[model samples]
Target: MRIISFQLPVVLSDLDGNRKRFLKAMAEHADDKDVIFMLPEMWGCGFDYKNLQNFAEHTYELISEIQSIINSDTLVITTHPETNQNKVFNTVYAVTKTAVIGKYRKNFLFSPTGEDNYFDKGDDICVVDFKGVRVGFLLCYEIRFPEMFRLTASAGADVVAIPAVWPEAKKDHWQTLTKARAVENQMYVIGCNCSVMHTKKKDMDCGYSVAYDPWGSNLYESVSGEHVLTCEINRENVNDIRQKIPSLSDAMKVFEIKRR
Candidate 1:
C-alpha cells in the first residue's frame, strides 16, 4: 500500500484558511486511490486551545468537506478537537470517501500544554481494517507511550499512523520514537507533523514527517518544510521480519506471565 504524509502549515484559529490549504493539498492527490493520507494533529484549528470549543462545534462540517475530497479506496487520517456529549476530546478520525472507518481519542494528552485539563481522555484503543491491511491511529502525545503501540500491534495493526504537531525543539525525539515504534513492533510507522511556525508563541513545529519500515529503515523523510511525502509499503516485509525475529510473540509470553 502507498502512504502519503502531508506536512502543511496549520494556521491558528483560521478554520476557513486551514480548510482551503487542506483542500489545495488534497487536490494534488485527488486521483490517487488505495492509499493512506495522514495529516497533523489539530489540523483544522492549529492547536488553538482558547478556540477549541468553537472548532469542536464545527468539526463535523470540516470532516464532511474533507471526506468529499477523498477517493473511495483511499483512507485519510486527521485529528481534531471533537465535541461529544457536551464534553470535548482530542480525537483522530479515519475516513474513506463514504464514511468514517474508525475514531481514536487521544489517551495521552500532553500535560505541559494543559491538554489533560481541557480534554477528556479516551479509555480504549482502536484499529481498523482497510482492504486486507489493518491500520491503527495514534495522536501526537500518544507516540511517547510504548504500551499503546504494543496494544495496537497486538491487535494486528500492519501500519500505525501518528498525526502530530510536535515542536521543532523536540525533533530528535520525534525521529527517534517513530523509528523505535516501527522497529519494536515490526510494522510500518507514518509520522506526519505540521510545518507551520506559531506566531503567538515561541513554538515552531519541525516538519520532519517520516515513514519507517518494519526493519527500522527510513522509507522516506521530509525536511523542515511543507511537503507531501508518498511511499509504498509492503506488508510482506512486515510478515517476514516478524517471522524471523518473533519479538512480539516472545513479548506476549512475558505479558502473560506478568498478568498471572
Candidate 2:
C-alpha cells in the first residue's frame, strides 16, 4: 500500500488557509499511483481548545467547499462535522472517490490544558480494510498511548495511520514513540505532523512526517517548515519483518495493567 503524509504548516485556526494548504499538498502527490494521503491534526481547523463550539461550527461550510474539490482515487484524511449525542465531534474523515469511507475521533485530549473540557471522547476505535490491507486509525495524542496500537495489532492491522499536530517541544517523544510502536506491534506506522507555528499556543510544531517499516526503521521521512511527505509503503515488506522479528507472537506471553 502506498502512503502519502503531509506535514503542513498550521494556518493558525483559519480553515480557508488550512484547506488551501491541503490543495497544495494534493497537487504535489496527485500523480503518485495508488497512494492514500494523510494530513496533520485538525487539518480543517487548527487546534481550538478554547471555545470549541464557536470554532467547530465555524469551519463546516469551508470544509464542505473543499471536500467538493477532492479528486477520485486519492484518499485524504481530515476532520469535519460529526454529530454525537447532542454535540458535534472534531472527528477525522477518510475520503476517497468522493466517498467518506471511515472516521476516527480524538479520544485522548491533552488533559493538562483541559482539551477534554472542549471535546467529548470517542467511545470506539476505527479499524477497517483499506482496499486489501488491514488498517487502523489513531489521532494526535493517541500515539503516546500504546494501548491504541495494541488494539490495532490485535485486530489484525497491517498499517496504523497516525495523524497528529504534535508540538515541537515533544519532537523526540513523537519520533521515538512512532518507531517504538512499529517495532513492538510489527505494524507499519504512518505519522503525519503539523509543521507551522500556532498563534494561540506558544509552542511550535514537530513537522517531521514519515512512514516506518515493521522493523522500526524509517523508510522515508521529511523535515521542513511544511511539506508533502509521499512514499510508497511496500506491503510485501510488512510480512517479512513480522516473520523475521516475531514480536507479535512474543506479545501473546503475559502482562499486567496498572491504573496510574
Candidate 3:
C-alpha cells in the first residue's frame, strides 16, 4: 500500500490559514486515500509550542469543519491541544472520517524552550492496526530515543511514523536518525517534518520529509523544502527482511522489554 508522508511549512496560531493549507495538500492527494495519508507534528500550529494552550481544540466537535472534509479511512495525523480531566496536553490525534482511532502524547517533548511550559509528556506508545499495516507512532523528538523504536518494533509493527517540527540547525540529526530507525528496526520508517520559518525561534524549520524501506533504503525524500514523499510499502518486503535476519528474535534474548 502507498503512504503519503506529508510535510508542511505551517504558520503558527493561524488556525484558519493552516487549515486551508492542509486542505489544499489533501485535495492534491485526495484520490490516494486508498493508501494512508499522514501529516507533520503540531500541524495546526507549526512550531507554535508556546501558543499551544491559547488556541487549543478542546473538543473534537470544534474541528469538525476540517474533519468533515476528510474522507473515510484516511489516516490524517496532526496535533491539537487536548483536555483530559483538568489537565491539558499537547497531543497528536489520529483521525478517520467517521471516528477517532487513537492518539500519542508527545513522549519526548523538546524543552530547550521549556516545552514542558505548554505540553505534558505522554507515557505510553500507541500502536494501531491500520490498513493491513501494523503502525507505530512517536512524535518528533522521541525518534532520538532507541528504546522507543525498539518498543514499537517489539509490538510487531511493520511501519513506524514520526511527525516532527525539526529545526534547521539540527537538520543533519533529523536525517541520520530517521534512516537509523528504519535500518535498526527493519521496518518502514517515515519522518515528516515542518518547513516553515519560526517566528519565535531563530532557526527555520527543516523540511526533509523522508521514507525508508525495511532495508533502510531511502525510497523517497526531499531536501529543505515543502513536499510530500509518497511510496508504496510492500508487506512482503517487510516479511522477507524480518525472516532473513530475525532481528526481533535476536533482540528478545539480548534485550528484555515489557510488552503491552
Task: Give the winner by TM-score.
Answer: 1
- Clash total of candidate 1: 0
lDDT of 3 by residue, 166-202 (tens): 8878878877888898888889988878777455445
1-260 per-residue lDDT for model 1 (tens digits): 89988888887787888889887898789789789888888888876877788888888787788888877888889888888887888999998888888999988889997988889888877899998889998887787898889999988899999999888788888889988999999999999888975657665767888899999988885678888888999888989999999998899878842200
* Model 3: CA > 4 A from native: 47-50, 58-63, 200-203
TM-score of 2: 0.87
What is the C-alpha lDDT profile of model 2 across 1-260, one tens digit per residue?
57777777776667668777787767766665566778777776665555456666655564455456555656766665455666756687777655667778767877885767667877667776666777788887788899878877876778888888777777788888999999888878988887875676465757877578888788665575766666667667778887887777667556532222
TM-score of the candidate numbered 1? 0.95
Off by over 4 Å in 1: 257-260
User: What are the candidates' C-alpha RMSDs?
Assistant: 1.9, 3.1, 2.1
Q: Summing lDDT over every window of 10 consecutive residues in candidate 3, give the lowest-scoring window.
A: 57-66
